[model samples]
Target: MKFNKFSKCLQIGLIAIPSAFAMSLTYAQDAGTRVAVVNSEKVFNESNLAKAMQTRLQNEFTKRQNDLRDSAEKIKTAAEKLDRDSAVMNEAERVRRQRELADQDRELQRKQREFTEDLNQRTFEERAKIAEKANLVLRQIAEQRKLDVIMQEAAFVSPKADITDDVIKALNSQK
Candidate 1:
């Protein structure tokens, strides 16, 4: 009967699908999938290059930071003096000093904004450089170790699968 033939075909198809899946799974296991995990935070923090870069940025920005600090101190001193002298100061003198204080405060704020923007930009640029260098080293390590996949961030990675130390070593070696 046609119904019987159709049932037989359906049974054969069902069996074939499971067999195909089993064969593919067997093939994949035999092919040896190698996976690795890298802690990018570790690589960035522990690398010699990153340390050097940080030191360089700190040194480069130190003078500007000091200048800003000095400006802030001057503004604070001026404001304190105005507050103390206002009781004795003439109307004209008090008004002039108040205006000067306001101007200085505005200037300080503008400088602070500029300094923050500049520092942020420089930090972003340097961090990008560090990341680029880390990625290059990561790729080299992966290729050398014959890794099929290297994860940057993971919730949990066994010590055996973590290649971050090797990556840090490579980064340090580049120093």
Candidate 2:
């Protein structure tokens, strides 16, 4: 009698598990999921925020760039003068002039290196600000449209689901 009861319980367990799995699958298929895609690169390239950042950086660095160019030109002129007059000068004077030229060259290189580092740091900061604003705009769009998911980078995205242009427009509208 115990053996018969054990067999009946085994049979019922097998039937119940398969039925439960099938019902869950059917329910998932019945529910529709909404999805969207955004091309972040396109938004960054086309947005007014990015453009303004570029302009600001150019303006900030222009004077420093021009000054560096002028210093380089002065150094070049001094080097040519030394080359031309070295043969006519006494040994001590020639050595002093050569040392001065080398010092100036080293100082110029140091300044150029600092300029490049400053430019790179500023650019990184501006890009971060743009990304922060873009994320806020993306969240707003997703909430407004009732989107379940918004993918930034994808291998393939249908045009029907692309909201990149909308993102650009929203960014342009903001200050």
Candidate 3:
């Protein structure tokens, strides 16, 4: 009976603490009603910074693609030049051609990987810059409005309100 009472008291305490905290939060919220939210995705997509980053990414991709095409063309040419007359071609010549093709393939693969890494790194840097700038704007807006809480609009389940416009105005003014 003593052990049962102890467990019941522990459970009651856990529930009571959370209930009290909830009531306190309600009271606090009632005292002042300042809140805001931002749509970061919208900011990143619509910002001029995003356009600049896209242009840079396109140039990098295009250059890499052109180089890969040139490599492929050279390999194709070599393949076309291969004499199917096995009887006429020496073993050394055949081995040399095979090695050349293998080397070209390796080079193409390496270039592709490097291009991918560069693109990824560039994207990381661009997003980091944009996110930092947006966050600063968000904080400024929150402070200006005396907001008690600022949240991501996308994260709110019901989305009772949207402060995207206010945030966007702040971001643009920072432009």
Candidate 4:
């Protein structure tokens, strides 16, 4: 399987739930406990910079795949031509073709390795930056809303409430 399918995105749920009877944030409340919800997925999906980074990574992978395929095709064509003419071909020509094929194989392997490492690094770095920024904005929004607690929408079983737009607004304003 490709690394992407196996590598799930990192999820950080920042929840400041009031400590119940003893929960820290709970106050002398006859009033219901205040809750704030932020949808991290939504924020990630909406970020323009994140989207661009994803597209760029995909394009890089595509280019590598195309180049590898082209190289393989050239090697295959060379082999076929050699097979047809082998009886009459000089030893030097045969050796040259074999050497070229070996070089191409080595180059393809090196490129695939480079792409895997580079793509994974870029993905991690970009995601970390985006997640950090989104969290910063979410925290600011929760403060502005006077929320007693803030939680990631997904982590909440029923998501008692949603302030995703508030978080998004805060994120937008941040820029």
lDDT winner: 2
lDDT of model number 4: 0.72
Tens-place lDDT digits, model 4, residues 1-175: 5666545432111232222444533443545666767777777777675677679878767887788788778878877887888788899988887788788778877887887888789888888888888877766766776777777765554444787766666666665
Please identify model 3 stretches exceeding 4 Å from their true place: 1-9, 28-34, 57-62, 76-95, 153-160
Clashes of each: 0, 0, 0, 3
Clashing pairs in 4: 19-23, 19-24, 20-23
Q: Over the stretch 96-151, how does candidate 2's per-residue lDDT look in tens digits?
A: 99999899999999999999999999998998998999899989998999876899
Q: Write candidate 1's Cα lDDT for 131-174 as tens digits.
A: 99888987897889888889888989999999988888888888
Report residue 64 deviation for candidate 2 (angstroms).
Answer: 0.8
lDDT of 3 at 71: 86
lDDT of 4 at 134: 80
**Index of the highest-TM-score prediction:** 1
Question: Each prediction's Cα lDDT score?
Answer: 0.89, 0.90, 0.78, 0.72
Error of 4 at 138 (Å): 1.1
- Worst-scoring 10-residue span by lDDT in model 4: 10-19
Error of 2 at 23 (Å): 15
